[model samples]
Target: MTPRPRKQVLLRLDPAVYDALARWAGEELRSANAQIEFLLRRALGEAGRLPGAAGPLPRRGRPPKNPGGDTPADE
Candidate 1:
């Protein structure tokens, strides 16, 4: 099935807060936007407000190679 488009949001944060978030994200190797989403999801889950149908976070980085050691570029 085709994946749905992700929603875009505009957020405003204090410089100090943003800096802290950016640093935390960097430590975790995640983007600021991703870090925000992760925290939001965690909070929602803890509060039992997360939708049952909510999908998991999308995978990051390169896709896995085939067992035959072939990739799309090799095809």
Candidate 2:
């Protein structure tokens, strides 16, 4: 599947708001940008404002070489 291109947005937040968002994002183990996107998606879903179905999210980070070949049982 072709990856969807993300839109670049410019957002302005108060200093305190930014700090709070950063802290919360850290706690959730997500970057501030990802945390913000997550929140926006949820809010849109709740408000019934979401666009047509989104494709499944692509897995983050590098894909494993040899797929499941790293397990001890396979060694």
Please give the lDDT score at residue 5 for candidate 1.
Answer: 88
Candidate 1, residues 1-75: lDDT per residue as tens digits? 666889999999999999999999999988999999999999999999999988888776655776346666656
Candidate that scores best on lDDT:
1
1-75, model 2: which lDDT tens digit per residue?
556887799999999999999999899877888888888888888999978766544455577776647764557
Off by over 4 Å in 1: 63-75
C-alpha displacement of 69 in model 1, angstroms? 10
Q: Model 2 reaches what TM-score against the true structure? A: 0.74
TM-score of 1: 0.81
| Clash count, one per candidate | 0, 0
| Model 2 residue 4 lDDT score | 80
